[model samples]
Target: MTEGVDPRELSDEDLFRELQHLHETRTDTLLHGSDDALERHTSRTQELEEEYLRRYPERDVDPDRLRSGARRRG
Candidate 1:
């Protein structure tokens, strides 16, 4: 449905919203959708994610989510 919109043209708020929507539907699309549908979802997800990263290159990192953090916790 959102395939018609380009990630580059979206605002920061809209891009994040689209990313959330895509992620929410990802499981169903992967398990049940057709190959064509899955491909489109994957492509759109990547485009939006890349744009988000481009805009927020300095996003805060959560060290507890990293590999080293896991080892420490264990």
Candidate 2:
């Protein structure tokens, strides 16, 4: 959506794939950038996730409980 970055040049499927790739690439870059930047980003993400979990407490479930559910019992 930026200037001179034409998605129109690609086929519909190619454009969609490219967009997905760009999103993942940007996410990877932000997640693994310089130590300070990565720490700040992680802190912000943790804050947001904690806020969301607090707001929707029922959505927060233990990972052990989830694993137990996935385990098969004979």
Candidate 3:
């Protein structure tokens, strides 16, 4: 539901929180919502992710790891 809010205006903590919420909502929509709902969620998730990456480039993940279910060991 944070459709039109400017991500740049949010504090880092708030941005992270919003990203987490978006991820959760996207997952829920994927499991139980209609096609239209999923589409909307996907778009919104992408927008948030782009902004997040822009602000925190180091947090970007490798596509291969995502597809292969690999976690970066700390």
Which candidate comes out best when scored by lDDT? 1
Please list all clashing residue pairs in model 2, or write none if there are none: none
Every model's TM-score:
0.92, 0.48, 0.64
lDDT of 1 by residue, 1-74 (tens): 55668878998889889999999999999999999999999998999999999999999999999999999999
Native-referenced Cα lDDT, model 3: 0.77
lDDT of 2 by residue, 1-74 (tens): 12323433545565456545544555776866787755654554444445445555787576657757667431
> lDDT of candidate 2 vs native?
0.54
Cα deviation at 71, candidate 1, in Å, is: 1.0
Off by over 4 Å in 1: none
Q: Name the lDDT value of residue 12 in candidate 2.
A: 51
The 10-residue segment with the lowest total lDDT in model 1: 1-10
Write the number of the candidate with greater lDDT, choosing between 2 and 3.
3
Ranking by TM-score: 1, 3, 2
> CA lDDT of 53 in candidate 3?
86
What would the TM-score be for candidate 2 when compared with the true structure?
Answer: 0.48
lDDT of all the models against the reference? 0.91, 0.54, 0.77
